[model samples]
Each structure stands twice: as structure tokens, then as C-alpha cells.
Target: MPRSQAETPENETNSHAQKALSLDPWEAAYLRFETPEEEIQKFIGRLNRLGAPQWPRDAEIVELFCGRGNGLIALQRLGFTRIEGVDLSPRLLAQFKGSAKCTVADCRRLPFTDRSKDILIVQGGLHHLPALPGDLDQTFSEMQRALRKDGRVMFVEPWRTPFLTFVHLISEIPAVRRISRKMDAFASMTEYEIRTYEQWLGQPELIKKIARAHFVPVHEHVGWGKWNFVGTPR
Candidate 1:
């Protein structure tokens, strides 16, 4: 049976997620790898879908929780200029490459002024938020507040489908409880699990509804244990 709106997971929390040594512990994980080329193309396609004459090369963009700015490297190649990364750790920001400014800050509370940004991209970052509806909801509102008129937003979040969810639980058990949460086991696991809260696992519909509520959703794509959204800020 398909999950009804009422069946959407809510108030889900895991004590283990809070036990992370660094909230954004991606410093070690993304410190070395380049963003997947396929993903870069996917994002570039979505961005190109937005502006008319041609994809605006001068768009002021930021990637929230951008660990080491690896994804920004890919975005730069896609014709985006004035790209910046906002992260919480200076250590992670230090690893960033490409010609981009890096800011150490919280995603929920951005440092930009109202309507200061042309685009906001949260690539593989939303799932790390505190696993509560309120927390997710606030993050959405903050993203909305940061956008200029006609500004677009895109999020590439981890998805949790049933089999993937099971894989995620197994991975989380070993990675967080047993292995000290210092590495990315999901990268090593062949299973399609996305390391995120139960509410988000395999729940693309819920993710769509959440984004649509805060903005006018332009497109949504889900597959490979990931959910991607492109939207116009409302």
C-alpha cells in the first residue's frame, strides 16, 4: 500500500545521530574525492533549465554545508561563477578547492542578507539536520529567506526506501555504534542505503511535499537512494 499523507513519518529522532563527534564530520570523508561527474551533470542540467537566454554564468550561488567544496568544483565547470560555500568547520572549509569563497557558518542560520543570494544548493546536506519535523521545517524557511526574487533552490538529499532503509540501519549500526562514526561506510557498502533519519529513508513523496510547501516545486527526481528537488522560492 502507498503511504498516505497521514502515514508520513514525523517526530523521528535517533540518539545515535547526536553522538557524532563533529556535527558535520564530512571533513574526513569528502576531503579527498571529487563530486561524481554524473551528479555534476544532473545539477547542471537542472540549473540550465532555469535561466532563459543561457544559463547565467554570473549567478551568485552558495552550497550549504559544503564539505571541502568538492561539489563547488563541479558547479564551476557547469558555468556557475561567484560560487561560495558555507560550512560549519574551518577545517573542512580549508580543504575546499577552485576559486570560491568559503564561509564558516550554520546552514539553519545563514550569514547572508535578505534576498542576497541568487541560488541555494543543498547537496547531500539536509539529511544531516536534526531529525524532527520542526527542524526540517525551519531549515526550509531559512532557505526561503535567503533567496532573491526568481531565485531557485535545489537539494540533493539522501533517500530511504524499504530495502535501502534496512541497509541504512545496518550501515548505521556498524558505522556509528561499532566503528566510531569516523568514516563513510555507506561509500563502502554496495547497498543503496542513504545514511539519514527513518522518516527520510525511501520517502520521496514526503520530501517533495516538504519542498513544495516552502516553495513552488519545479521538478523532483528520485532514484539510487537519493531525492533531488528543483524549486522556485515562494
Candidate 2:
């Protein structure tokens, strides 16, 4: 997969390249690996912390890298109506069973017009990008461009905390993994994208710094092996 260039035009050529980059391992196993109810609960908690409950039901919202649309489902359950999703994998997007429009597009080059979206959300997706600061920075730039001046961005991604380290250590134990379905699934997922996962894990602070540079922080939480962030465009 090519490293995503900043402000790449949302054209047919770019779209094809982006789709080629979408050869994600999770695309094949995500449905089998995740428990939808549990995933939705996690998304609900994150969205609530981002003040989703206070937002109007008709607010325009888009979720990038929305694998299988669990986050979209959470937004729907919260009463959000004008919701949309974007991901590179068509197969994963096909699994989405919601009213929101789903598009196959690269996060680094969003299809939306400037200042057109009210809110942008990403859950457990950034860490999948192979390129660290570059791809991540490009994605953030695209996000800022696509969002309205007052638009908000929310994300929850894996963090390299002590608790996460401990979980990783224990997850290595076959017996422990067998006893915990969540752990087993997590282990399997991480193993599938270990290279990119480890790249993100080693630089949690850098990731936060990049995000902070793009948006002014409104809320931030780093714990439980996750970095939850909410911000408005700078």
C-alpha cells in the first residue's frame, strides 16, 4: 500500500489506488472476530463521553474507517439520523445494516467537500495504517478539510499503556486466551495486523501530539489500552 499523500484529489485514479491499499486482513475476519453487541457498547461509551447525547438527532455525521458499521449502529441507537460511513473495504461496508450511506474511500483523501460535515468519528481504525506520522497526518489534514469550522472529531484507538502491556503479556498464554473470548479475539486481531499495530503502539504520545495539532482538544482519556479523544477543528 502506498503511503497516503496529503490532499490527494478525490478522483477515479486516486480511488483505485486507495482500494488497492485496502487489502486489510481484518476485512476477512472482522465479522467472525468481533461480538457486535460488545462492540456497540464500547462505541456507545466512547460516543457518550464525546457528548453525543447532546447533539441533535439530525446532525450530519461521518465515521471514517468504520469497519462493519458498529459505530454507525451506535450512532443510530443514540438517535442520530444523518450519519454516513467510509472505509476502503467493500466487503466490510456490505455488512453494514443501517440507514447511513457507506462509501469505499481512503481516510487520507475524503470524498466530502470542504466544511461540509458536522462531525467525524473513527473507532479503533487509525492504528491499522502502516505509515505512521505521514499517513496519520494526511488523514488528519483531510479530516480538518472535510469538517465544518465548528465540526467535532472523536476517535478511540489502541494505546500502549502499562495495562495494555500486561494484557498483551497475558494474552500470549494459550490457557488465558482460551478462558476469555474477548482476549482471544483481541489477540487474533492484533496478530493479524501486528506490524502496523506495533508501529502505533510504540508512539502513543506522538499520535496524540499529531491529533492535538489538528484539533483543539475538548476531551482526552488514555487508559484501558485505549486513547479516547474528542476535539473541534483548530
Candidate 3:
């Protein structure tokens, strides 16, 4: 039988996006090789520090944009059960659902009830949207509505300035350039959807949005110059 649309890789081109199709076995293996274990550990430790104290006891955790179930697996390893993974890709979600529960849907229009989960995680996923003024606030509000009282949302996003610079400097290498071009990746993106993201680039606008959504910033860490925000719903 022919591969399903969800099983086939689309004509995608981006330096970073190719790494996201964690559903493909060879592609997944390549990304695993590229991933820096030490850096990943440090990032997880940062998340651990911010989340440990506030983590609900065996609470229901929801991971949004859960590409390839990496974060879900990580949380499971960390002793969190009752986890639901949500993603936009059907193949990825299907693969994850084989061993765990997951849903395929948009984050803005979550299917679950309001304040249903104790923890929500968006890892390297939120920044994929068009960065614009007010867009972050909109996303934060939606996340808040999806969380229970005192629920927490953790996001790991590129820090814009440094991240862009780093990618630019390193992407010039022959291999990186080739991979990036093949992946249709750009060094930086300014989405036409929200001009607010343009003006607020590299700023704490994201944090401010979370705060406005009644989420208190409980922790922040800068690793590989990336920003990780850990906040609690008020």
C-alpha cells in the first residue's frame, strides 16, 4: 500500500524544521546524533529546577505540540503519569498513541475542558508561530484557560538575538548550509501575521504576556543562550 499523507514527508525545506519530523526513522536517527546530550541534560536540569517544587503530585500533565513524543517520554521518565500529548501531525501523534495517549489538534483550540491539566509544556514549539505583538498574549491566555488552578506552563524558546546570531554564524558551514537549504530553513523569521513580534524581538514580551495571563514567572534559565520560561497559573 502507498504511504499515507501523514506518513510521507512533505516537500519541506528549513534548517530547523527537518529536525522536527521525528516520525521518520532515518531522519529521527540523524537528529538524535545531532542532539547534544550534555546540553539536553542541562536544559532538562533547568526545567527540573523550575518545575520540581511546583510539580503536582502525580498530576495530569499535557504536552502541547509534542513532536515525536520526546517531552512525553522525558516526563514519563521523570515519574509523571497521566500525560496526554497533543500535536499537529497525525503520523507523529499516531506513533505516540501506539504506546501512549495523544491528540492531533491545534493549540489555540484545545479540545479538553478548561483548567483540566495540572501542567502544560510547550517545548521549542511556541516560537514556531508568527511572532507578533499580542500574539504571545493570546497564546498565554489560551494556555491559562487550559490549566487547572495553580497549574504550570513551561516553554523553551529561542532567545531571538543570540539564537539568530548563533545559527547564522554556524549555518554558513558547507554541511549546515546544505542541510538548512534542503530543510527550507531561514536564519530568522519575521512573520507578517503579527508585527508585534517584530518590534518585541529579543525582548521579554513573551514573559510579560504570560504574566498578563495571570501566570507568575517562577523561573528562567539561559542555556545555549536559549530562554526557558517556567510559570504557574494564578
Candidate 2 lDDT over residue span 97-194, tens digit each = 88889999989899999999999999888998879999999999999999999899988888988999998988778998888766776677778989
The global Cα lDDT (0 to 1) of model 1 is: 0.68
Q: What is the C-alpha local distance difference test score of candidate 3?
A: 0.63
TM-score of each candidate? 0.69, 0.86, 0.68
Which residue ranges in model 2 land beyond 4 Å of their true spot? 1-25
Give candidate 1 misplaced runs (Cα > 4 Å). 1-26, 30-54, 162-184, 187-196, 202-206
Clashing pairs in 2: none
Prediction 1 TM-score vs. true:
0.69
- Candidate topping lDDT: 2
Q: Which regions of candidate 3 fall more than 4 Å away from where they truly are? A: 1-46, 161-164, 175-207, 210-212
Better of 1 and 3 by lDDT: 1
State the lDDT of candidate 3 residue by residue for 1-234, as single tens digits: 998565555633442365464445533432343233433464457557666545754888888877667667666666666888887777556545335588888776787888888888887666545554455666677788989887887877656666666755675456775666422233222222124444444466645565546678787666664677778887
Give the whole-model CA lDDT for all candidates, comma-separated.
Answer: 0.68, 0.87, 0.63
Score residue 13 of candidate 3 by CA lDDT: 42
Per-residue lDDT of model 1, residues 29-146, tens digit only: 4432234555456556655654322537798888897876766876787767789999887766765657888899988888988889988888777776656466678888888998
